[model samples]
Target: MGELQVEKHVKYILAVEKRKDDFESVVMEHLRLNGAYWGLTTLDILGKLDAVDQDEVISWVMQCQHEDDIAGLQNEDGSFSGDMWGEVDTRFSYIAICSLALMRQLDKIDVGNAVKYIVSCKNVDGGFGCTPGAESHAGQIFCCVGALAITGSLHHVDKDLLGWWLCERQVKSGGLNGRPEKLPDVCYSWWVLSSLILIDRVHWIDKEKLAKFILDCQDKERGGISDRPDDAVDVFHTYFGVAGLSLLEYPGLKPIDPAYALPVSVVSKVILGK
Candidate 1:
């Protein structure tokens, strides 16, 4: 029942960014672009985005793209690879597009083809997968749906059917899982909840119970959230936990756009060209 330690969470995120050579950073180096989005979005939601140097962060983001590792990761079909190994996934497409869009550099990619590829991953169940014919999963669904939303291609989604599927992820625990028959995790709070809101089906699930689940996972002592209560905490879950609360209209927190996963203010400036 304790309050969210906004300052402590902010410090944790900042510390993660500052320790460039740490074990966690080393492991996250492969997807630093996505990590940046998560951290930056969390900061903005907490109303502390100005704490970092905008120009410096944007420069690093651009460099992360142009570097030989991530460059040319895009396939002919518009799918993106996570690294030089060239494994394509809808998740990469979402991360890359989101990062560039936030930096006001969407012109750098073939957005039309990107949308086309995501559409290719659509399933008859009104859900999307990592690639064509892959079974629909909540995590992949979020990435695909989010990318489509950012690009104004939401018309591609079948709101009712998809909403039904996403809403079904909620279990008796009031927590949501990535797919049926799986244990609900706190991270899905963002994935499932955001997808429902985007499709206008949020009312299908029990928001009150879900909020309580996320709150229970918070480490009131250490100031971060975990995937489940009484478990170890990390920055990733911490961001999702807070973002989920933001979606739930928790007081004292900035509103987060379900699709872009960024603060309403930052999304407006970056995507709306305001």
Candidate 2:
């Protein structure tokens, strides 16, 4: 089952390569930093970074920058633009930073403007929103925290309030939600837990229940993970499933540094500031 699942993921990667022009077409069609980041990061995680031209990728990602400081923009409709057509959101910003850092283009980013954009996303609740004036969500908070961490500006966030918001995500099912009144899901387990780890307050939540919920979301027979128990499995949830387990220090699973939210093997080199 495990090998088959691995093969499925491998085929996804191969498909991305076999249709490189199509992939690039989609990327260019969006032409946003975050979208470019998503494409590059997906390739990077798959060990296919060389499949795309580093310089072209770097240049395209750079085009999404507003000056050197801010990395994303608002779409014409103002709905949280990205390389897609919407206003900027914290999640994409996180992806953009990580993608650039992974590509070793950290030096080219305008740290200050990026910080400004991150700061702008902060809400009165002490947590961050996807965009200015939006409600605070666990996912967006992760992006905000992650972007700041990459740029060495994590201190700009209000940790106490952010921690409180993250802890509130835990529900009776041992799962976490992205926002208030949302259903518990496995993906948020990583989003919320990683945020807690970032602020060193993971202990405030129910760890045992959270871990159980995550495990239950795994497709033991299929060797992948779903957003919730009995849900359809996909790559996004599968990656987060492994990530959440790593956050809990699960035995036999690789550890993930919540601060960088990448596998320890990859995050360690990033932390070394290389």
Q: Which stretches in model 1 have alpha-carbon errors above 4 Å?
A: 15-36, 50-73, 103-110
Q: Tens digits of per-residue lDDT for model 2 on 210-243? A: 8788777766664556799899865567667666
Looking at model 1, residue 11 earns an lDDT score of 80
Candidate 2 TM-score versus the reference:
0.70
Per-candidate local distance difference test: 0.87, 0.68
Instruction: Please identify model 2 stretches exceeding 4 Å from their true place.
Output: 1-81, 84-87, 270-274
Global Cα lDDT for candidate 2: 0.68
lDDT of 1 by residue, 1-274 (tens): 4467788888877877888898878988887776787788888888988988889999998775554533266788989998877788999999888877777777778899999999999999999899999999999999999999889989989999999999999998789999879988899999999999988899999998998899888877657788998998877898899999999998889998898887887678866777
Question: Could you give me the TM-score of model 1 versus the true structure?
Answer: 0.85
Strongest candidate by TM-score: 1
The CA lDDT at 199 in model 1 is 84
